[model samples]
Target: MFAPQSDRVALRFGDRSLTHASLAACAGSLARELTGLPRVAVWATPSLETCVAVVAALLAGVPAVPLNPKVGERELAHIVADSAPATVLAAPGVDLPAGLDSVPRRDVTLDGDDPGSFADPGDEAPALIVYTSGTTGSPKGVVLPRRALTSTLDAVAEAWQWTADDVLVHALPLFHVHGLILGVLGPLRRGGTLHHLGKFSTAGVVEALEGDGTMMFGVPTMYHRIAEEVGTTPALAAALGKARLLVSGSAALPVRDHERIATATGQRVVERYGMTETLMNTSVRADGDRRPGAVGVPLPGVEVRLVDDAGSVLDGAGPIGEIQVRGPNLFTEYLNRPDATAEAFAGGWFRTGDVGTRDADGYYRIVGRKATDIIKSGGYKIGAGEIENALLEHPGVREVAVTGEPDDDLGERIVAWVVAAGDAPPSSEELADHVARLLTPHKRPRVVRFVEALPRNDMGKVMKRALRT
Candidate 1:
């Protein structure tokens, strides 16, 4: 995939860099060693070694399971036992967790002669077995086939107008799909340059975009930080203004931050929607309108529909319902969980478990997850995302998460968990009124709790489940 641009720079980690020729040579050498393995586990730290290991596994036609470095002992143990990898790959001199001790380790080296071209692996072959966050129960290993990767990558490339000339920059972790698949492989498949920030900082963003960085991928938290300082930091705004595209994913970027950044830099941040099971379903097109709160239309070759509780497909643009998708972007199945895999699909369509609505222009706006973001209160089904976005517009609201709690009268009462901005925080009543005025009276928070900060996961998504507790 990276052969055409063999001489061009492909991957950069801090000061270290690798050309396409060098990366292919190293990965090809490693691929020779990985051949015929049932599956290999990659200690996916944000580094060049992790990138090479994954590419090598794919080249060898063996499934690669990316292990999060910060995984808990029990979760790690579960993944290790479930996948039962033949061996684990990591960088030299790194200490692996005790949970991975069961598997033999192989140290990846950059210096290696190319093994020459290899035969094409069939598209049906499994490429990566990515484990979900396991919020509902134990993490299920999601089996993503080669076709899914290629199709999703091609679809997104078409949506963003991405090409070899574009230089992508991001600081997302290597364990998940956003960072590994799109952030890493997307560039490689396009034969483009990818500069991975060892860590994310507004300063790092400025330095990168100010250089040759043409595009950026980040979550809402990162963009929120950028929005907070971009107005005051002229360099940041200037760098962003020079970029071709700024993309946000993993979570919804608040409308307030979108306006702030666009106002300061004259560049609107593009948001896309996807999950571990489905690589990418929708994205705001590069040539289309950059609407805030909307994730844009479904990508080419992918189909999306909204379904009601009765399993009836909802039509038109106004109704909010659970989103279902169908396309080559769908994952094959959950490893070792046939029942769960069957449960994930209905009538040939994958149940996304995410609730959303479409506009007249066919743009999709995510309301939140069906399990947590849908609030049934006062005989109305209100989406938590709209309320959260409304609350974010208030001056005193720094960060906020909206959830539904048990209520005798309303069935589920809307509650807001807020991280206030200034010394004088907005009162609960004031915040409630603010939401009611912006949205609807029924959507207003019946209860409000202020905190120093909202609990977030590694990807910067608000842990609404944690907040509910």
Candidate 2:
């Protein structure tokens, strides 16, 4: 919930700006029109219209489903049919694909007057229905309640020391939780200002931070690009050093890149852990130690535990196990999938499907996802994240993804898909020896393949599933 602010600027996109009063007036007008709809769809583009549409839906107490603009025809059709939105909202002049033609279209306009006042939607009310990436099958619509959004935002606000005075800057997409909920709604919930770059660029980051921007949120891919150029670009480093906080999420920020950014800019990028189902679970605190590879402790009111395969809760930090979480920040259910909703929970906790270890201090270091990131070779169950981090430390290695392949002898063998740093890349044997020396002999990649680039999704996370295929 946003507190009343005067005519202060609330959102900025490129040269366009929206004051708190103006945004409320525009969204409130649309909210009046969106009222009584079963559900609505927002063409989640990185623009102010998309922001207005989502906020309007929330104001109207109508569940809003965010559709990725880059979604394929098949996935788009599936989402449209599943959510069955009453109308699709988009910016004027934006061309929506044919998949969305089944629903009527409404263009969001900025010139409307506020619709007096509205009643509070109960905490249990569905605020959003966001679809997952569907790594295994068709993407499932995650139903996020009003309480989940409020609770997660409040928890993170406490963790990050975020307040209305903070001017947030980021270029993350608007479809997923990290970008849409955190990047966009997080600021609004705090009654703070947001400066969204229509597209991410080093120059834009420097300009925003050098001016009024106090915090910046980015994924690993964006930070990696910053790390590569920070050494050569003094302005980039200087601008980053001036920021109050720099956060990275959606995937692990390689320790190598973390160190480079820290060394050059004298700032450690904070990492947080969460998914589509759970808005946020853990985050590195602003007032605490800035650990390079740790995602930090669980947020306030959120419970996290490590569980072994036998469904036993593991204690302490030595052993890596599945991360189970119970929190108010969790989504209510998978839309129309009661079977999935029932299976996702273990007893009372939501199974995150992520494997990690928690130290005695309560800090969490994510190993990787259990489905794609855990590698079983010989008698050891290795996490691909650690191996990827090790490989990234090499001077000749630019970007890398580690996966496991079927092997009759070892059950599964570690394989490295690397993007080289230079023309003369390190040989497979040399790289294998490098990893062996850094980690364990068995942890070394038994098979190495050189590639120009690792396949990545919109969030900059390496699509390991694509590599396996």
Candidate 3:
């Protein structure tokens, strides 16, 4: 979409700003260098260099697989063995493993070559392979196509009314779809400038807001921290008001936190829904009322249905069922995992494994996930999110994770791992009593353990399986 006169900035890092023309030239040169390489693996270390490699790969028709650069040796080795890319673009000083061509940023040469008018790829051709957050154990690479990108961008733009003037403050990482595709690609496709940041801090984010940035994209945890940081500063509060829209994703934004952010920032964080398999399915409106806890109607052209265990569609709004989706943005398949891909789909609709209920107003509320996190206690199904939300309300709690622990009597018991805000947290009995006041007695956490920090994977999702182990 780059024209000679196009007023767009492709990247902004520190004092440097790469124009669309420069970015196009660099991508083409990188593409030329990567010619004949079977695959390119980018260990996503937050940078403009990583962005250049990704866009260059797309333009070059080479499959680019991005791995979590922050992961340890164990996780990193698994990704390298799985994808086996011919070339790797990584941060400087990170030793390259055997049998891969690694290029450092300073060594790469870029003499202008046009990133010619991009011709959108077929619906079946693989464009990118994003790994799931290996919260369970090993992560699976979710293969997405070019059509998925275009279709999703169109749908998102239609539903949220994104414009060329909108500048996005990208706090999320480039490795995750929410951060890279939705945060970077969505705005770029509309000819918007992405004010990129390597890491997020209270002052840095506030500084980005002071610029031309009109929109903000972040996970719920970030909003909570930013809200806390902006407690009583009128200047910071007014700076936040400059943002036209704010999006919350990766995890659902709790009602209390959402309200707290809106009160401090003057912009209600619009909650949306998506995963690695499907880039984005639904989003709250840009101009209308954003209902708390409900991911508003599906984006344009995306079909959503609630189905029971029998795969039969539910007719009422009161019951929660598996949220299934079939859309243009849905991935073509899981990379080389035919059986796993086959298992993910049922009657053409991809089973999201998430349980949700639709309201009369057409808003969808996520209740729980099917496999790893959802817990059933006594005769009632419990969503760990409820307890986690309530736990966050306590002033002593810094972070909380709830999971199902096996029990002989209730079939399953609620176990919570908490990171305390202060040096000393409340006693387990006291914390249990606090949760009991907010949740039903049966739903209250029976086991509360104090920890320095909750174990998390590269993507920042809590590793509940590891916690159980």
Give the Cα RMSD of candidate 2. 10.8
- As for TM-score, the candidate ahead, 1 or 3, is 1
Alpha-carbon lDDT of model 3: 0.74
Candidate 3 TM-score to native:
0.77
Candidate 2 C-alpha lDDT tens digits along 1-469: 6657458888899998888889999999999999999999999999999999999999999999998786656567778899999999999999998888889999999997894587888999999999874334456899999999999999999999999999999998898898889998999988899999889899999999999999999877688889989999999999999999999887777788899999999999999998878989999999988898899999999999999999999987778999999989999999999999999999989998899998889899988667887665543446677678778889999999989887644546899999999899999999988877655576789999999888999999889899999
Worst 10 contiguous positions by lDDT, candidate 3: 99-108
Write candidate 1's Cα lDDT for 272-379 as tens digits.
999889999999999889999999999989999999999999999899999999999999999999999999999989998899999998999998667777665543
CA shift at 170, candidate 2, in angstroms? 0.2
Report lDDT per candidate. Answer: 0.88, 0.88, 0.74
- State TM-scores per candidate: 0.81, 0.81, 0.77
Deviating ranges (above 4 Å) for candidate 3? 1-7, 91-112, 117-121, 134-137, 373-469
Question: Which parts of model 2 are misplaced by more than 4 Å?
Answer: 373-469
